[model samples]
Target chain A: DAGITQSPRYKITETGRQVTLMCHQTWSHSYMFWYRQDLGHGLRLIYYSAAADITDKGEVPDGYVVSRSKTENFPLTLESATRSQTSVYFCASSEQGRETQYFGPGTRLLVL
Target chain B: DQQVKQNSPSLSVQEGRISILNCDYTNSMFDYFLWYKKYPAEGPTFLISISSIKDKNEDGRFTVFLNKSAKHLSLHIVPSQPGDSAVYFCAADRYNSGGYQKVTFGTGTKLQVIP
Candidate 1:
């Protein structure tokens, strides 16, 4: 509604399948980020976008792809989901040059 | 290779007591630090933050202390309440060659406040 949101709060997919997680922000923040939360790794960044057309890779980007066609939307896609990719994904947004981020409810994905 | 590390996986403190969460970083170039709180099935919300230029930053019931030399930071909550029980994450940020700042998060610490 007002803040940020992620679609398919929960999803289950088969291995080698393709899946996409959607993130939308109403604040129009310049920076949007995608992160995966795992057991030992609290939250590892997958990708981040500086603007509508500018995206960059983060620590863990090997299996993830992100695109920002519009300022309010940043979607993350898994070309071929694997079992190791199963985790809770969070989307965050912030103003340019600011480290403080606002996150979405997150999508819990399971790859079987 | 983890720049930010939160060694304590969990902590418990009695109501009305002070809850301290510590975090350490190995990167000497980190210029900013932040703390976030996340509840069950909820996203992390920004709690408090401090810059390398400042040693401490305080809010209502929360205060963040930073030690640049030791490469450590802490979040303290006074008069801990049950509502404060949640997973707290420590994050660090440093500007890279790119124009944007790259932020890294710690493993997080689950703080439980007993009522």
Candidate 2:
């Protein structure tokens, strides 16, 4: 219970519906990241937050929106889910930039 | 384009033998590199890492070798065991990537240890 945790480890949603993946870390790390893992693409960063109210887009952030209102939580929302959005989402946290990150179990989202 | 590349999709090695997993990078600005191992239903955990300044770094049975000139790196596991079977990802740190210190990861290589 001391490490990072993601809500709804498995999710099923219809296309065009909105889905939000929640990530909470108890460590209060300075940097939080969201990544999606897909076949042939590995893990691509979708968004990252340096601290509360500070967030930036990553490699593939077009279809996703992220917000960090609290230091302990960073949530990712898919405005209009599509089949291409079906992938495993991971949340990671680090104390500093370019440091070792601790990851959560991951949330598997399927868009039908 | 993929900044980090792991050409091998999977590899099988006999138990007690050495297992080699390789990675290549296209970016010359990467100053740090890391390897992560992941099992099904679990998040990836850091395995080992080496700085561009050093050619090698070792921890227990895991060792990471970085060749800055060739833009290549590798992870070698000695006495490979069945427990070592998992997906391994190589990551590179782009420190100057807009202050975020973005890490580009390879697709990953799955290693299987046959007894």
True contacts kept of each: 0.95, 0.77
Q: What are the per-residue Cα lDDT tens digits for candidate 2 across B2-70?
A: 999999999999999999999999989889999999999999999998888899999999999998889
The alpha-carbon lDDT assigned to residue B14 of candidate 1 equals 99
**DockQ each:** 0.92, 0.83
Candidate 1 has a DockQ of 0.92
Measured against the true structure, the TM-scores of the candidates, in listed sequence, are 0.99, 0.98
Residue-level lDDT tens digits of model 1 in A1-112: 7999999999999999999999999998999999999988999999999999999999999988999999999999999999999999999999886758999999999999
Clashing pairs in 1: none
Off by over 4 Å in 2: none
What TM-score would chain B receive for each of the candidates shown?
A: 0.98, 0.97
Q: Per-residue lDDT of B1-115 in model 1, one digit per residue for the tens?
A: 8889999999999999999999999999898999999999999999999999999999999999999999999999998999999999999999888868789999999999999
lDDT at A3 for candidate 2?
Answer: 94
